[model samples]
Target chain A: MILKSKVAGKLLRIMLISSIIFAVISLVTTFLFVYNEQLYLKIYKFDQFISVFYMILYYLLIIVYLVWLYKAHKDLVELNTMYPITPKGALARVMIPIYSLWGMWNVYSTMYDHFRPIKSTEKLGSQLKVFIPFYYFLFLITNGLNRVLLKSNTGLYEVSDILYLVSYSLDLILLFVFLKMVNIVMKALDLLMVVKQDIIDDTQDVSGQPKVSS
Target chain B: MNLITKIKEKKEYSLAIILLIIPLIAAVVMMYPKHEEFVATGDITSVEELGVEGSVYFTYVHEGIIENLYEKFSVSLTSRNEIEFSSLDQHQYENYTAYYETSDKYKHNTIVNAVQNAEVKTDSQTIKISEKSQKIMEKSSDYIGDSFGLMIAIGLIEEWNDEDFSQNNQYIISGTGTIEYDGTVGSVGAIRHKLLSAEMNDVDIFFVPKDREYYADKNFSNQVEAKKVVKEEQLTVKVIPVANLDEALEYLRKLP
Candidate 1:
């Protein structure tokens, strides 16, 4: 019992550590995405090449981190004898990278290829419509980890800043929500393992068979 | 373990589904473009002008008989022809001068003859034996409205089409106008006073085409002198001159 508890605790720790690392990486990348593009445009005036390169590198790091996380998750699940790998974990593992990359590709296309300074109020509204959704997802994931990365300003002169702040804050909130969902997933996995262990113990007398050690 | 079971059983897949849909919606919106439309209204006119300020010197010899004296009389005529003309009035004289100096040389040399021959001056004004044209009004581009509100008050001018021409609206109205003085001080006095009242009454539009032409044409020194009359339509509803229909339409669209 002690050994099993220790092993499960170790797995839980691994999951927590990996999730934290993943959240941190995603948060930093998003911050870099916003700050480097927006602030650098005003202050540093970096060219398009540098801006695009920064984005690519930022996303690449996120991809590598996610891959490392998934491998850790797979390894941890392989060690568990109490339950089979949940289909939800499999689905999450498949979706996280694919959808993430899809989202990143969308950002790349919009920023590098389609980006233009808005010329009119009507155009600005249309552009915001296209942009708000993808950012909303990023928001959910980021805010879940208790990180607040957006600021606000007032008046016409700071209108752009206010919009930026609001959009990023909303994105962070969405990201946080997603992270909570991930936590729910992790907790459910823990409960499933506990239930499976309970079932195996209860069935030992009926089959008159030696219980498999968890 | 049941936590994972719950995650497996009731996980929301809609977020990913929403992600897929947004881009498609964006793509549809981006691909379809809307055409912009502009509305315009007003009087339209164009103006051309010509001015000549020079002295004419001519000498002629004539045989004259007075009662008992038959004598040779030599007359020298020297005068200043300081004329300011609108291009419309000068159009007839320009062709006359061109033909007289080149083809005709001398035979049919009167200004009347020349006017009779021109393609544009098909209708000639006959001098009435009992009375002459009291005043001739000529309209020109320079014939601007005396008061800004006159154009708005008159039904003739509107910036944009309104369902009702009410007492209040902010839109521009433009037109050229002229009033003639019939050589008599009395008539001039009456017309001037009438003009003032007409402006106040929003009846200023009636003075433009006919009244102005009668006055200005009579004021001109001679038929040879240039006279300008701004066309009625040219006064407000501005239209661009283009060589072709397509170009004209394009130009019209570009107007404010």
Candidate 2:
């Protein structure tokens, strides 16, 4: 059993909160521009600055996530991973361009398969496996729909605009889903570490004095 | 016990280190945020060797220092992190919804007329905007305004005529004004930042709406304010005031 670091849990929380904040910022910015175009331009002229802030936050989140992912993969390798992948090998698949889109999907599937047999992580592994593909399709559809709607020049504030609202709403939902998945995994990891520590403490208490010969 | 020294001996210091370091990093990152993240910069298109230029625009986003401070305390107090829109203070959103609705409704007219005044005959007089142009038409960017009309009209005229109006083709030029149906130029708000952008990008000449009509606050007009900023800041970019499309064309024709 792994003894989790306090830093990892705190970072995970930060990562989750930052993603939500970033999304809310995006929503507010978009809402202001549509609801009050003139004032948005005149007053809140910090649009580009905000985007740079978003970029920095986004990159920071990615770094922390990859580090934890690498550690998890390392745990599998220590026990002879079924897929014959190293922690570095998994990272390479994710970071390499053109190959990454497919590579990241594969990495998720491999993790799911490895973890599916473990009693503690079985439910999470199964849930992730189901959700991963659904999330992928949702991502593709939302992007495609937006491109189509934008190019059509059908104008805004019409029947089709509802689709725009839907796409954004779905985006919000998926972001929550992604963060929730991370949260569940993190909590499970924490629980496993705590349980292991407790069992060790109990054993030490039982063996406090040597047993007398029977 | 040796992997992380302090953390290996005591796991809780890991949280302490992270809590202290994150806000410091965020503060540093905020110090150097940029004003422009460009889709295109200082690029002129050549249609049969005539230069046609357009003003660049970027999509928008929001951020505030208050949110960062709020987040620092949020994680410590609660497990459920609720998304809050009220965190952003009250804005022009409450009073200007009707204005936004009307402008957004008639937005296409501004774009179409700009193309038409350039006298570029389209397929049955219906303006088929470029894919990029279409995206900017919706309330998607700050560029969705009449101020961009003058440069776009000029650019279209050059493209349709297949020759630069000025014929010098030496200096990069750009500007802003509303294009009326009869080819007249009208005033638009917020010229100071646009002028600053032009200077920073080294645009040689910029056309602004001439403040011909007298008002109690005529100095607040696009042309007058642009000139004032140029004078005060000693901006290298020249600001030229024009009454209409013909006036701008006349000045450009006379440019040696």
Best by TM-score: 2
State the displacement of the C-alpha of residue B178, model 1, in Å, after optimal TM-score superposition: 32
Worst 10-residue lDDT window, candidate 1 chain A? A149-158
Candidate 1: residue B149 lDDT (0-100): 14
Q: Which DockQ values do the candidates obtain, in the order shown?
A: 0.02, 0.05
Q: CA shift at B180, candidate 2, in angstroms?
A: 16
Q: Which pairs clash (backbone N, Cα, C closer than 3 Å) in model 2?
A: none
Q: Candidate 1, what DockQ?
A: 0.02
Which digits, one per residue and each the tens of the lDDT, describe model 1 over residues B1-256? 6765654553232322333244334434433322211111122221111010111100111111111000000011111111111221345445544543453222212121212222121233443311211110022112222211111112211111222222232222122221111111001112222222333333312222222233455543111111121132122222111222223223323434
TM-score for candidate 2: 0.44
Model 1 per-residue lDDT tens digits across residues A1-214 = 2122333333333333443444444445445555676654453222222323333333443443344335434533543533233324533533566574455334223322211332222333344445455545564454442232221111112234334445445544544443443333344334445555666678786576976667
**Residues B1-256, candidate 2, lDDT per residue (tens digit)?**
4768857565445653564356446645554422221111122222212223422221111211222332323222222212223232234433234444565544555556666677643233444555424543642343333556666677666655554754554776777777787888888655665666576666788788887574568787777798788999899987889988888877876878
